[model samples]
Target: MVLSELAARLNCAEYKNWVKAGHCLLLLRSCLQGFVGREVLSFHRGLLAEAPGLSPSATCRGGSRCSPRARQVIKCRNEIMHSSEMKVSSTWLRDFQIKIQNFLNEFRNIPEIVAVYSRIEQLLTSDWAVHIPEEDQRDGYEGETGSYLSASQVNEVKIELLKEELEEMYLQAEEQEMLPEEISNRLEVMKEFLRNNEDLRNGLREDMQKLDSLHPPNPKRDSKEPGRETPERKD
Candidate 1:
């Protein structure tokens, strides 16, 4: 029932633009979530930027920062849903199509749907991108649309992180350079002292053995020796 009505609306030129755009956005979101396996409404383009090189570090740190384009798309989606007239301009439509195309391109080979939709976008006419920007002028502009970081702020944050890494390296280098020579010298001295003690101990043992051989103990004399006399018998 739903697909029949969808087909009928798609057949109509007037509703075709909105229907196709809506379907494209929906499919795009689904593909993104299918790849990310998480909510993207909060961090649409930011998540896309990180999704291709998805890492455990990124997954553990869950908050997503929105990209400028993703913010614009979100605004466009919101305006369309909230407005009573619900119309868009050709310029905005083209931009939206490009945005979705770029987003889906990030995860090209991972999801089959992404490849299918990308080809579909290429084959389909820009008539699908026929909406006008003026129609949605009341919604918001680039700077005013969504809550996203300015390019300057992002740069500043990157610089600060780099500065921290550099600082850490400098401290490590300073610690290593300060005591390496001193520690090595101390180790060499201790080894030399131990070698000298070992040599002295060996020399002393040899000298004692030599003296023992030179001065052998006097042998016990027998009672019948000529110089020996027996003492008178005693009780």
Candidate 2:
């Protein structure tokens, strides 16, 4: 299975544990494509945006935003999953597989990426059946839902459902007089359970650790330093 291969490619202990998280990403991609019945980039972007804490990293290792490595994975996933009249060449798929392996290797070491992975896993595992379509099930697909419509009929159904949800949210926001920024932030938090948040979970793990693997907390590199730590919150 692709999931097993992904796990084997990430040999490190941290990566081994994160395999479940990677599986979550693959599942989400399949679910979104199946539900929307379209493989367009905007649809992909919209689904990901709505999911809490599920954004591709624009920067890596002090490099430029939307780094080539990240872009390649996104492109590869789209091409492979959305194979159409202009089918992706086998050569590209082979190269993309290697890129994905390398990308996961780099991704496993970064705390932010780890956080994103965990958050997505939490979301998918919690309530995925409501979004994925039954007709979208392929050979390897494994989601907890039955077929509702044929693949051809799925797009219209999903579009109408999404439209109603968006309208309801808009009306609710207007009723509450929430600002645009506040509404956006609240939407991200809505998908996650408070106790299962990465920050709280990681903080608890930190307290139990015999040693801090990231090195002794530096006063100069305290939580205040940009990119050093997430902002601290009172329990």
Candidate 3:
């Protein structure tokens, strides 16, 4: 539904083929002023020249205070995604609370976007780490396994979620410039996740193919390596 709206608004001819959230952002870049839409906007490296400037660190600490609110949102997302500890500081999360609201306000006219406002507020105002009851802990995930997800509608939602994860994997491999180890670990997690979800495994063959093709490239050699060798051998 969201994609349909974006397709209509952006006049994205290939929007029907777009399967990930990043695709929407990619299209949005072409509309921004001073942008030729050529460079890698996926990294949010090109949004420093407009509207509500990015918040704390839009790719770097003490981020641009004059870029689009979207820039702040994107940078905050990148920070969380790239965190090795899989955690964020309270100050950072609190700042995100402010930034996300500001960003969402930018699209107040979009009903679908605005609909999640209350939900976002609920999430942000609470503890970042969910505190499950002791009973739930003891029963563990076994109590809920496959029982609630049997509906076709639920399956479709799961499929979309898998596509989003695949999209992020693509970004990590092709855009984030992650270390080879980091990419490899994430790849294994994704592979195992797919293997467990038979429905997803069967439904997302094409998506999985793209992920497979994104095998991280070999790490680039650093010119400043400590043991760098300079043998005088002719090729």
Candidate 4:
């Protein structure tokens, strides 16, 4: 019924500029469908201003003289408008609260995320002591020691080197006055690379730690027997 009224109002040349007028009527129609519609309607009508801005009194224009049905319609319209406004306001507030809660949750997790990233960085950059064979130690060290390094460790070093190179390139590009857009694009790529590197490093560290803990390092054995004496000591 409200939709029909809106269509009629819109079709009328006199109501072309009264688009807002139809909105209030539409709200009333929706409110009337609910179980509390009658109560809501009554409350709004009682609160309605008679004759535009005047209080409901005998002296108010048509306030005391309107027919019962006309008065009911007027009251219903007022309630519909108020209820619509309240619904819009409440919906907006709920959305705003949800957004605020999400922002707070993100803020709270930032420190823990940063700490994990730091741990990842430490693990990536850590230098493990490689024990060279007795023969290899005597020869002049040429390339990287053949002593085995974990694949994760090598990848970490590569990432660190790439980061340093990227920083240098960025500085050089800035010095040469590269276009702002290009510089921004390059920075974005660098940031993405760093983020990926951190993720990879963290995952590798976790896996390695788990493996190490599962199979602990073997205890060292004494080079000499407790009851045995060295031949040189016999002299």
Candidate 5:
């Protein structure tokens, strides 16, 4: 919401079509055109060092950058993502909400964009019910689909967990200079599953690309007949 609006406000006609990218701020930084800190976005958002690039912005507290709200939020995001747990305490979430809310308010002129504040509150507060197929399959199981987290969140969580595990397997294999058969099979299965699920595929598009790079596909082998095996060449 914010990216598209920023693009509109900036009148970036040449770069209006690049939306829905997964690397949230990286994409924004590309379109920033030196608006904020240019080269040190990575460290600026890190909240570890003081830099002038992210300063004097609507979202950042310039000069006295003990803890700029934008940097704080970005730091928390990195913690959640790199921790691999993808979990944050309720207190952390409430603090995050406050910081992000302030950032969002800076662009309150965009009504459509500001409306996301309510939606974020809704998602943050909503209870996610676990679906137990064995119990749900009972003759008189009546459940309200609306009583759970949005489908996108659920699907993303599933794919993220799988991706985390698969990534670990691949990393371990790469370090050993070998790809285990089990890891190879798991990678193939994940590729197939992602191929079949468009929502999952698009949501994790960048992640999937990185994962593929870790284990490049053999198109020749894949295109061959099911019963025919490609011969390995030895020098």
Candidate 6:
């Protein structure tokens, strides 16, 4: 198929599985080709250095340069021999063929992908399983005892604490009681002191207001005063 048509097919939901399979295959092919190309180039560079008058630098630069006639010959040979080699039997080629067949099988089977995903998920969740304790085993005696405190028992403890606090307050107050008559006399003295202070403060405030009113400003003081001089003439 044309590359554009293949790309369009890859975009369709119906062909998504095939597209993903093909993409993976293409990536693997590209990586293998790159690795093989590097190996071939290295070998060819070394081979070229053995040729007459070719230094390592010259070999590295001119290793891939071939004449147009040689290119046509190589292309024609590849076209004729490459397709026929697919049916040929050789040990290394058989292994490669088997691998390709297996890859194609896995690519066609969606269950293989699902199974792989499931296995990965299982592996991930295995850590979670390891963290969780078995039901038969108690976590710890201390934690179990702490967790065993019932709601009613908790409330009873709180009530007992409050009762003890109240009793202590009562005993302290009983030990430190004030005399009744002395307390009453103190209360009466405080009332008298507060009333006297209020009256004194009110009197002070009224005096301040009266003083302020008596000291009202006089703007014509210079003219009204007996020793005041009038303005002299400029002449």
For model 6 the local lDDT of residue 38 reads 71
Cα lDDT tens digits, model 4, 73-150, are 455334322231112233433333343233224434444333333332332223222222332331112243222333
Model 6 lowest lDDT segment of ten: 123-132
lDDT ranking, best first = 3, 5, 1, 2, 4, 6
lDDT of 6 at 102: 47
Query: Which of the predicted structures, 2 or 3, would earn the higher TM-score when compared with the native?
Result: 3
**How many Å off is the CA of 90 in candidate 1?**
2.6
Candidate 2 runs further than 4 Å off: 1-64, 86-89, 110-235
Which of the predicted structures, 3 or 5, would earn the higher TM-score when compared with the native? Answer: 3
Better of 1 and 4 by lDDT: 1
lDDT of 1 by residue, 164-185 (tens): 3234333433466535444334
Across 23-90, the per-residue lDDT of candidate 6 in tens digits comes to: 23333344345545776898877687678566655534456775554354344323322221112223
Give one digit per residue, the lDDT tens place, for model 3 in 46-164.
Answer: 45545357753655556445458877878865654444333345566667778877876775765555555654554445322212233232111223111111234334544665566
User: What TM-score, to 2 decimals, does candidate 4 have?
Assistant: 0.20
The runs of at least 3 residues in candidate 5 whose Cα sits more than 4 Å from the true structure, single-residue gaps closed, are 1-67, 130-147, 150-153, 157-235
Would you list the C-alpha lDDT of every candidate in the order shown?
A: 0.46, 0.40, 0.50, 0.38, 0.47, 0.35
Q: Give the RMSD in angstroms, all C-alphas superposed, for model 5.
A: 15.5
How far out, in Å, is residue 230 in model 2? Answer: 76
Candidate 6 collision pairs:
none
**Model 1 clashes, total count:** 7
Displacement of residue 157 (Cα, Å) in model 2 is: 18
Q: Name model 1 segments beyond 4 Å from true.
A: 1-14, 38-63, 119-235
Instruction: Give the true-structure RMSD of model 2.
Output: 23.1
- What's the true lDDT of residue 98 in model 3? 83
**Top candidate by TM-score:** 3
